[model samples]
Target: MTEQLEKLNRLPLRDDLRGLTPYGAPQLDVPILLNVNENTHGLPQEVQDAITASVQRAVSGLNRYPDREFTELRTRLAGYLGHGLGIENIWAGNGSNEVLQQILQAFGGPGRTAMSFPPTYSMYPLLASGTGTRYVTGDRAADFTLSAESAAEQVRAAAPNIVFLCTPNNPTGTALGLDVVEAVYEAGTASDAIVIVDEAYAEFSHAGTPSALELLPGRERLIVSRTMSKAFALAGARLGYLAAAPEVTDALRLVRLPYHLSAVTQATANAALAHADALLANVEDIKVQRDRIVAELTELGLQPAASDANFVFFGGVEDPKRIWQGLLEAGVLIRDVGIPGHLRVTAGTEAETTAFLTRLRELLGA
Candidate 1:
């Protein structure tokens, strides 16, 4: 492996990517799989049947290239969001990551910078690098919270061309308030920054937690990206969409490939949305598991941040990797998110959650 890496390194590679390692969360097979924050619940039979039918209908259309505009899909997404939005205000891609990449391509590059809070999503920096945009990071508070004042301060300091705000932030599982979003937007006006609010876990958030979508009415620079991969239990379908101003979607058109979304993908996503309620039925159940993990972990003397997302981020570990390994040995898998004393675990099925917390409690005692 070393020799192979050495040989590959000898070849010409992008200067920025030279020493970089790929983003990876271990995809290990275990009796209880909860590392990546995916919904452990299986799709409902009704949704599965709908998807099968939709794909079958789309099969005959394969002879022709998929729609370059993907107009109907955009409309369906807008309706799902229900803010008087139209097809003009929506965009779809293979995944939220691709939507984010196209966003950087259009609004960030070369001399421009893309900024985000660290200990959040790992992919934001990578996406910026891939687009030739300089990556900048700000620090979150000790509790993994970012106040509007501090967030606005960073905006002024970085003067970044693009700013990413991940609500119900990855790894931390803390949701940002609209006040923070507005404050950051206010500061960005000085630099004309495009602020992206990644709401991939929106559907999994606790009830009454408002989305950044509410703040979009008059804010043209704001973009709220979401996905069916999590709460909708369609991770295998690979569909992510964004709701932005018509102009933003129009700007993305300049950079996106024609027919970037395939027929199969479009069919699959539309089918899922057709059964949105059923697909989302497990959200509350998952929330129960999420809360249970937090409660039980806290009872065992760990500090778990309050989470609106379907995962919990906890601290106070003497040895995170040891606990992580012990869980693996016990046939469960979780995430060591590179934070010093912290680890994350998705709220899997009830049985899976029971196994994880039970195994973790035993390891702590040992």
Candidate 2:
């Protein structure tokens, strides 16, 4: 490995990317996968049939490049989002990561800056770096929470060209109040910055926790990104999209490769959206497991944060590494997230959840 790495460094790689590692999590073959926060319920049979049929039809058009605009996919996504959005207001890419990368490509670059609060999504910094945008880290409270006031103040201080706000934040599973979004937008106006609300886990948010999509009516500079990967149970399909002002989509077109979204991807996403209700039924079940994890962890005297996404993040572990390893040996895999005394677990099906909880209890001797 050392020799290969040394050889890789011999290439004339870009200076900024010289030592950077790609983003990923462990893909172990375990009986239970509670890591990566995937919707482990698997797709309903009906949605599966729909996607397969859609792709079968799209296969005939493989000889031609896909619709560069991906018009019907955008329309379906807009209808699904439904905040008075139209096709012009929607844009898509391979996944929410690519959607975010495109945003950085369009609005962030050399001499420009992008900021995001930490203990949040890990990808924000990577995307900034990949796009040559200077990455800036903003502070969060010791508890890993960011209040509206603190967020707004941080924006004013950074004066960045772009801002990423990940709600139901990754690695912690805490959702932000829309007031934080509103406040950050107000603060960013000084720099004419583009504010992105990454709602990759929005569909799994606890009831009555409103989405940033509600704030899109007049906030032209604000972008709300969503994905079919989670609640839609289409992670393998890799369809992620955003709702923004029409002009924002136009701006993205300037940087996106021609025919970036393939015909089959558009077809799969359209079919999944067609069955949104069936797929979302699983979301409700996952939420039950998520809440159960939180309640059980609290009962165990551990510190589980208030979760609005499909996962739970908790501390109070005397030995996180030991617990993680014990679970792995028992064929259960969850995320350690590089945080001392803490771990994150996705809420899977009932049996999967039970397996994880059972193994965890044995490890903790609770």
What local distance difference test score does each model get?
A: 0.91, 0.92
149-206: candidate 1 lDDT, tens digit per residue = 9999999998999999999899899999999999999999999999999999988788
lDDT string, candidate 2, 1-366, tens digits: 699889989999889998899899999998888889899999889988998999999999899999999989988888888879999999999999999999999999999999999888889989998999999989999999999999999999999999999998987889999999999999999999999999999988887999999999888999999988999988898989999999999999999998999999999988988998999999999999999999999998999999999999999999998999999999999999988889999998999989998988898884
Q: State TM-scores per candidate.
A: 0.98, 0.98
Assess candidate 1 and give its lDDT: 0.91
Task: Give per-residue lDDT, candidate 1, residue 58.
Answer: 96
Under the 3 Å rule for N, CA and C atoms, how many clashes does model 2 have?
0
The residue ranges of model 1 lying beyond 4 angstroms of the native Cα positions read: none
Evaluated against the true structure, the overall lDDT of model 2 is 0.92
